[model samples]
Target: MASNVHSLSARRTAGKSAAMMPPSPPPENLELDGLDRLLGAIYEGPMESPPWQNASQLLRERLGAAHVTLMLRPPSQDGSGAMINTGPTQQQHVDSYESHFFAADPFVRLPEGEVFSAEELIGPQWLQSQYYREFLQPVGVRHLLGADIYTREGIECRLRVTRGPEALPFDAGDKSLLRRVLPHFKRAIQLHARLDFLECERALFAGTVNRMLLGMISFDQNGQLLETNQEARRILAERDGIWLSGNNLCIDSSQESRDFQRMLRQALSGGTHPRAGSEPELVEAIAVSRPSGRAKLGILVRAIPLGPWSESKQRPAVAVFLRDPEANAAQPSQELVRRLFGLTRMEAQLALLLTEGLTLDEAAEKMNVRRNTARTHLRSIFCKTGVTRQTMLVRLLLNSVLSLG
Candidate 1:
């Protein structure tokens, strides 16, 4: 078996070299125009949308591949792995591959930074494996180029391009292109995860809070209603000072209600301190005579920060969950380099240090970087980011960028 594998490797190398003969250059203007349109569509929104499909199709077209497949790791137990196929036989090939060959597939297990070649995997020795012979050969798959998609969560997905007998060997240019697009893919996947998580949490929270006897409402640090229990909505409806206006839970308060309003505002503005004592006291003091002879109303407010969700160090927004008192309070760029900007764990830590108002020298000391080298990295960051100053960069990240979510 070992000797057979070696022979297969030799054959694959020869085949790959033979296949490397250059093809005629594609129309640069036309290809660039198509790419621009495709990128625009991809950036516009959801993956399942028409624009996204168009972009994927265009990529396959431009790459001149026989098939393109985007597979997402299943999000839930019952969620079958996501497979978007652009060729007639691709879906069957993928289904068979997943069912039969995935476990023994060498390429799938490759490290995050490396790319895998189909020629290597499709070598004669690999074909000798019963699983590959019976499953893969039947499917007519001859080559594959797979790039890892690393997320803050971890390396959970991969993007694969496949070809058949007519397909050429994957080149360095293909690898570079894949690397360039990988970040965008990562961001889109992350955004999708965030929206899905938020929706699930909102549904669960709404159900749980609505069942509670106490009214509950949640807001972002900016006082925007992040969520509200049904009870909270009902209670707000009864009160003249607070009402639901479109999406916002509007609060009306007078001088007497100022303190409660202020506390709510502070909490909404990302203030971390608990207001339990202050809130109940203010609620009791503000209770007014109602026609029914019950005390008017009061509020209990608390600020909760959703901490980092993954190893990425991106912090989620602060959520202020509240129970109404008679009071109220208030408060409130980037392109590819900006949007695609990512750092390794170490780089992110360095960014955090810098954001904490550290001078390059100080940051280097803290991070144990030599001052000159620290200056070098800082320069790289600035040039890659187009930010002129550390202060501006830090400011950009202060509220928006987090090392993790």
Candidate 2:
């Protein structure tokens, strides 16, 4: 959501004589132009930020009010509400209102969504009360006009125009303009809330994907990187078999890169082209050679679903998944392997090492186990896991759910 842009400070006057006179009638076209600008600003971002500030300033200038405030009322006694005021507001007045006076203000009691003047709510006798004399008087508030706007989030948003004691009272003309602009203000705020919701959902999905062992990257039709989550960032930073070239994902081998490019293009094109007698199968994975010649970086390119109702109209059209067997193996999932396949902790550790491209002799040396002991674990692993070859065992370990965490 767009955040609030600016705040106001109330100005303290030595004497009422120092205050500026009310602005003369503004040109009608100028007011209309301001409304048009306000509407455009609404589509830019959430109204909590620049739009609210801009609206207040424009309304203040047009209505010739001493100040303008548009904010949400506190929904709960303990909750702070949204506030955007047009000023150079006085800190003293601001503090006083925030501390206590706001709750006592008679304006909140007015009927919702109706424009009313200060006199309509409080008469001369009511104005004699301490809330007015002590709080309103010191703040230089005299006459005012405002209306309430309903938000989609069920918050009561209020807009108020205030005048100084020396200024003319808010008249029908001022209220008329506010009434005209109120609908646009409400719609803009609702639009902001909707956009904010969609943004939150996207973040939640990305977070879940990031927690997986795979590194995920989203790219557009031109292969421009669009988004990469936390795990993807860590993998890309390694600059191993697969790395980013400028903003594009690149593979170490040229042939592999060509294959990847064709696969991505085919997927995005909906696999329309026929190969021999039938449409080619979608390529699911590609292997990139590592500099260490150990475990290669395994990349899986998948197409984002495309349709009229699909969410990818503006988002990325393709996503790439990267798996670093060596990196994921380094994490202590040995206990997980032990429990899943009935292997001892030692045997699990040996299996993890083999997934890192360690030969039988190398793994035996690293684990400080004799050749016979290592071979014994290997035979037991094959029988229990139902995979006879080392290569098959390595693939099984990588594919296992235990490797994800």
Question: Which numbered prediction scores highest in TM-score against the true structure?
Answer: 2
Model 1 lDDT on a 0 to 1 scale: 0.60
Report the Cα lDDT for residue 83, model 2.
68
lDDT of 1 by residue, 1-405 (tens): 999999999999999988997776679976677767766655653546422465567667767777766766722334456666676665666665566556656556445656667556456565566755676556666667887776777638767776676678778887776666666776776876776689799787566554443566655544555666666767667755656777564556455357656666565453343333433221212332234334455556655544333222122222324344333211101232234456444455566677666777888999887988777777777776678888877876654523212
Model 2 lDDT tens row, 312-396: 4445777888887766433547778898999988889899889888999999999999989999999999999999899999999
> What TM-scores do the predictions have?
0.43, 0.64
Which stretches of model 1 miss by more than 4 angstroms? Answer: 1-58, 65-67, 74-101, 104-106, 125-143, 149-154, 164-176, 183-214, 218-226, 230-297, 300-405
- Candidate 1 is scored at a TM of 0.43
lDDT of 2: 0.74
Lowest lDDT 10-mer window, candidate 2?
1-10
Q: Compute the lDDT of residue 338 as modeled in candidate 2.
A: 92
State the displacement of the C-alpha of residue 71, model 2, in Å, after optimal TM-score superposition: 1.6
Give the range where candidate 1 is weakest over 10 consecutive residues by summed lDDT.
328-337
